[model samples]
Target: MKTLYLDAFSGASGDMFIGALLDLGVDIAQLRTELQKLPVHGYTLTADRVAKSAIYGTSFDVVLDHGEKDHGFIEHHHAHGAGDHQAHHGRHLHEIVDLITASDLSATVKRHAIAIFNDIGAAESRVHNVPLAEVHFHEVGALDSIVDIVGSCICLDLLHVDRVKCSTIADGSGFIEVAHGKMPVPVPAVAQMLSDRAIPVQQHPEVHTELLTPTGLGIIKEFVTEFGPLDAQSAVQQVGYGFGKRETGQFNALRAMILTTSQSQKQTAVGHDQVTLLETNLDDQTAEGLSFAQEQLLAAGALDVYFTPIQMKKNRPGVQLSVLVPPVDRDRFVTLMLKDTTAKGVRYTTFERTVMQRRFETVTYQGLPIRLKVATYQDIRRVTPEFEDCKVAAQKLDVSLETVMAAATALAR
Candidate 1:
């Protein structure tokens, strides 16, 4: 499966998104052909090879003569025109959805396009204090945004991309002039969208402009699954550059690339997770406190927590608290250790672990619930009875714990 990585270095815009895919090798002619499936008309979809800040990239544009706003038109930058100046009326969120759903586009393309529009509608509804069904999309509902969004989706479908990832967005800081008058750079809808989606934004102290657009953010938040820096492992097949309508001192472009599965991602398909080991030595805490810390860490999602007897400075006996936790849960687990243990310092290291796929099932043995943990690895499998369950069953049935365990084990087999 091919994976697409979106580098939101210049932030994201509908135009930039389409341009990047075009540069990544999506045929512009074919893209335009596919977009013809949409029922809406009176707009032109164009992609041209352009240079911005001395870097060449595909610049995509959707042009219309009638609309409340003309988006993707940037000044102080140079690019060739690829769209016709056409006359078209602006649309509402529901109208756009109807147009897409009514189109001959594939089911996936129509679904994704409407979903992206819905995100924008939800944010606009919240920011403007209007019902979602009644929200009027001023700029996003324009012909340009519509084509850019739907066209972008069709391009992705053509590319046959299986996964989408992006970097921490460089959301420009400052103010921008909009139909609602001068507003913050992120704008109310963009801010609300970013806040609602929980997408990470990178702040640059020098740049002051609206780098990331509301339409751009909504598209990414809907489809892009992972967010962070580059994936050092995946081998790059091709790099596509999408240009934005800005004149920042640096090259203002979105660098997207296609990648093959990395070794780690391949392992993850078989029930493995990247983990971080957090370790700290506690010399002053009482034994009971150490015991409590282990219990807390385990309950808080640590894969495993254990204590090792050790000799610290001055040959004083100490216990090393070690915790294994998934990378996503590292911070929470680390915070837990710090708050629960007497150690003033903690350290962690990341590694990969092959965890056998496992699940639990309840079985009635002697009218008591006996939990069986069934674990599998390829053709190998193991079924083990829960010790706690067996002990409870023994107490309730007036039998030895060993006898209860044997019965549960026999039933599991």
Candidate 2:
């Protein structure tokens, strides 16, 4: 099968991702024609080979026609300079989903686009604690992000890529002021998205700016299977670079490479990522307190959490708390661990972990929500519903949890 690997040497954004794919030989005219199927209007497509920091690559853009009156183009408010020419861009998650569903795009392309948008919506929902459908994509719901997403999908379909892998993602540090006041760099949605997955990431040492956008991370999360450098077994077929808007450094570009992979490599490439492992010892905390602490750690962007039984100093039985997290989220989670538990200190280490590429599907049982998860390996494929979703259905049906789980399992099968 064919494979595509992304090299985010500097950072990534919606424009950079699409631009790189265009440089990888996706026909520009055909991409424009495919995007025209969307119900959105008042925007013109633009593509060119641009240079940043002396590096050259294709730059893709969706130039909004704010002057047009036919598509209800109202003057958008850019309170913090994010709305200057970016007017009427904010739309709810459900609205965008319905728009894509109504478009003339192919069913396969539509599914890929919606799945990406769902990822972004899920991240926003977690960051704001709002319903998935109710999350307003203030920055990503705009015309360019919409085009970037759909156009990327169309190009990938045309290229016939079967798998995707990426290098360690690079992001910036410090604060970024946007439409919703000043937020920490990387943005809450981007940070939350990185936390939810096993994608390896690092902070850009020089620039304190918004390097990776929420839309960009969402796309990466949906398609990228493994995180790290590509293996030497695959033969590279093509190479392309997508330059970002910034010209501060040579790392301000994303590189894409097409490769021919052997079957053995595909089976072994499912999940490989770098993460930080944090541990602490606690003896005085109650069971209820530990449960709440775990929930808070998850919300604060922990990858995994668990406890182990151990004998502390003086023969006292205690629990050893373990937290798996991304390096970018180390400080925040560490603070929570120190504050929430009686432990005055913590121990941590960084290592690489491999996991299977997972997919999520939501099914409804008599108006109750049930989520199905699919995983891939060498020859084994696993499908199961999220336990929490099954629990809720069980309560609604007044049935045993195991019975509800089995019913959901049968439906998934």
Top-TM-score structure, candidate number: 1
Alpha-carbon shift of residue 142 in model 1 (angstroms): 1.0
Q: Model 1, poorest ten-residue lDDT window?
A: 71-80
Q: List pairs with backbone clashes in candidate 1.
A: none
Q: lDDT: which candidate is best? A: 1
TM-score of each: 0.61, 0.59
Pairs of colliding residues, candidate 2 = 78-83
Cα deviation of 152, candidate 2, in Å = 1.5
Which segments of candidate 1 are over 4 A away from where they belong? 65-88, 262-413
lDDT of 2 by residue, 1-104 (tens): 46789998777877888889989998888888898899888788778997765877888776777742111111122243555443356677778889999999
**Candidates' RMSD to native:** 19.2, 19.3
